[model samples]
Target: MNTTPFRAGHVAVIGRPNVGKSTLTNALVGAHVAIVSPRPQTTRHRLIGIASYSEGQIVMVDTPGLHRDFGSANATAMHKWMNKAARGALDGVDAALLVVRAGQWEEADEYAYQALQRESLPVMLVINQVDRIVDKDQLLPYVAEVTKDREFAAVALISALKRKGLKELTRDILKLLPEQEAIYPEDEITDKSQRFLAAEMVREQVMRQLGEELPYATTVEIESFEVDGTMLRIGAVIWVERNGQKAIVIGKGGERLRDIGTQARLQMERLFGTKVFLQTWVRVREGWSGDERALRAFGYHD
Candidate 1:
């Protein structure tokens, strides 16, 4: 008979842009609840990913990257919203994971650490992408330098993409959580709805397929998500800031848009475990990223 008590609680996964927070969350949860791309600020919302084990459940609050440019003159409404969403994830959480890239700690990393320090929760330093370091011996010195002045509840060197050092990380995180019943059912993977996930799946492909500047100017909205028998019919609008951007997304003879839809539909089918009929359209919404009303209309609100 098992005598150990089940532990479960929320843990805020906080870090700078593209530090593998979403990747870590998806890995721990054993599902693609959060989208990932090579671009910075790919995650623009507060998403919850639930990881269930026999002994505990980790309700991970996967947040947007904590960036410093939100207060800058060039910062748009979208930037401010993303910043707010990241900060908001710290509230009422049992612990926080300050994930940073291996062998490098920049100003943005320090900024993220300071933000976590403001919160009273136990902040664990997750040194992610450790597999990228060619010299493994230098890891200890790098970790020492980062942890020199800061107080961390625990430190973990992990390669989120490679799934290395995860069991120990999970044990450390579970130890920080209180002993209690699971917050979510064992089978549940995320707190987001199917409709929201559908929109994100499309946006993930947009970020993957488009160029640097165009992705930041784009946002996806699901115009329709309906279930017909065993298949899901999803229609998404890829909103760009200009007509020229729309032309770029559509490409010559609409190949780009079709590819986006095809990839996104396959992802949806894999995630939702059903056939998906996906339709995508590129529409222009000029300066929508800077417009607060437009941001709300496209579901960027808290």
Candidate 2:
């Protein structure tokens, strides 16, 4: 007879910008460890979400999208930092999931695939956003083109928005993890703290609500987090690169910021299971995204 414990190990989710990496992480872990937005580069930091099962566990690492740096004059410091963070997470991981949109493969996907090929580990090609595909037969050619020059342990067709084909993907992932004991408590959903999640919650609203108002220069930081009884109090700062961006975020009469706060606070209440009091402040940081010290202070790790 063969006896073995549950399997568990880190699996890094990698792909180009706006390819549903964060959505897949949330579905795999059954919790929101990373923020999702329609705009590209929604995830700026590396996040860990843990999922435990009777047979094994999967620790999912959601990283920023892979963006190449050619050392051109227009390459910002933040872009380099984010790309480094994503590629660095790939090393020393048990497995990787390369997510891509359902339709045809683009050059961005090729860039991400090239990055995954360098890792000497099992990589699963995740074809996401199938719900958007009108004709199912069209997927065949697309799949062939995507896998033509690449090698993958497995490929899964999934619609992260509709939550389809996730079970099969999970089953395949369970088999790839190393056989070992659980790395975290069974009930734990993620390795991140409530503070980091709260900050991300605020950032999500900013990205989703203000994608047009502020496309590329906005980040959130939690100034204070206090819990007492069934109530939680949090103060956050929204840093913008320019004063005009700050005004746009705050809006006339502070209406826009209030909307962002209301949405973020409601999500936090659901996640924490407590009434939340959240205060938000917007300020102009003037090139913080390009400043190394500011990026570190905002929790950007190499």
Candidate 3:
């Protein structure tokens, strides 16, 4: 089975919360395959982003951040799922890209280092958010610290938001990839379906417009999706932890909620390439964060 063109396999991009893992995955794939926001754990599921070059294809797995200290059942499950996605889903990956924030290492870095050590996998150390640093020389010490581990194949600095050093990094990654056949069909963009992306897009909108407090306590689920010729009819529910937050999301006279709906509709229209009829409702799911059943209903595992 010469899967040469199928240069298709999983490559996991992992790091602590808000380290630009999602940003990098989106940048590499040249699309918004994974949702991005300032909030931690914005990415709760493992998303596959495909980046195809004339020579090969790289399917990158963007997992949720590893929250080492979360003790709640839901948080623990999330953390375990993240590690499982990396180890199990990306087991035979040609290589791993370990993303770290630039400037200095922290306790999280130590944990990441130890995790990489156990895998015995070749790692590419990426110092993300270099655009935040003014002096190029300042990044050298960080590079030096990472290269101290002989397990690293190469080190590169990048700003995922600005798309810097991505080309070179992709080239290096492709070089290390095995000569396998493409794992996906040529036009396939992600492992998730349009329904999932629609839910995520709405969630991203909620996070972006509703601000931090409400966003973290919120989850969106698409209850129904129907495509009829020239338009898409979507029924969605937005879950908030409390009654007051529900009022806030729905807004005064439903103004804010309407605005959110308008924004989401436009994006969905563009994504689906058709007219979108989006209807939203709010629900009060007390302590939804701790509710295993609620999480599962919203597509997170128990």
Candidate 2, residues 56-99, lDDT tens digits: the string is 89989889888665234577878878887888888778999999
Instruction: Give TM-scores for every candidate, taking all chains together and pairing residue i with residue i.
Output: 0.98, 0.95, 0.90
For each candidate in the order shown, give its overall lDDT on alpha carbons: 0.93, 0.88, 0.79
Better of 1 and 2 by TM-score: 1
Error of 2 at 214 (Å): 0.7
Candidate 3 lowest-lDDT run of ten = 70-79
Alpha carbon deviation, residue 175, candidate 1 (Å): 0.5
Q: At residue 39, what lDDT does model 2 achieve?
A: 92
lDDT of 1 at 295: 98
Please provide, for model 1 over 1-302, each residue's C-alpha lDDT reduced to its tens digit, 9 standing for 90 to 100.
99978899999999999999999999999999999999998999999999999989999999999889975779899999999999999989999999999998999999999998887889999999999999999998998999998999999999999999999999999999999999998999998999999999999998998847576989999999899999998889999998899998998999989999999999999999999999999899899999999999999997
**What does candidate 3 score on TM?**
0.90
- List clashing residue pairs in candidate 3: 3-180, 3-181, 4-180, 4-181, 5-182, 6-181, 6-182, 7-181
RMSD of each: 0.9, 1.8, 3.0
- Which ranges of candidate 2 are over 4 A from the true structure? 1-5, 70-73
State which candidate, 1 or 2, has the greater lDDT: 1
Q: Give the per-residue Cα lDDT of candidate 3 at 1.
A: 61
lDDT per residue, candidate 3, 1-302, as tens digits?
A: 65434245567787777899999998988888888888876887888888887667888988777555643354644455555554454466667787888987777766766676677567788889999998988777767766675467788788999999999988878766777778887677688988888888888888888766675788889999998888889988998989999999998999988888888888877766789999999999788776666677788762
